[model samples]
Target: MNLETLKQGRNYCKSLTLNDRKILEEMLEDDFYIKFHELFRYMIDEDLKLEQEWFG
Candidate 1:
């Protein structure tokens, strides 16, 4: 997973209106939510690891 892509996705999410965010939150509660959440977390963790390796 590309960190830049993740950052872009996060920026897009942050740009959403309150109602849009609420709708997205509801959608995320569906059956695939756990898998999606896991994948997102993995990507973030991987990105953080890479940043630490590069900067430390």
Candidate 2:
């Protein structure tokens, strides 16, 4: 769980955008690891949805 590292698509402190900040804020304000899982899940899910809608 190296949050400092840049992932393939998202969740990098240095690479985060404005909207990413909002999502991060939402994630950090929740109940610890469960929220962290939800946040990570949401990131992957949204990326999948966008890809499906755009290129499927």
Top candidate when judged by TM-score against the true structure: 1
Tens digit of lDDT per residue, candidate 1, span 1-56? 34455454542332344564454456457766655655445443443222222331
TM-score of 1: 0.35
How does each model score on lDDT? 0.45, 0.44
The TM-score, computed over Cα atoms with residue i paired to residue i, of candidate 2 is 0.34
Error of 1 at 22 (Å): 1.1
Off by over 4 Å in 1: 1-4, 8-14, 38-56
Cα lDDT for residue 15, candidate 2: 36
TM-score of each: 0.35, 0.34
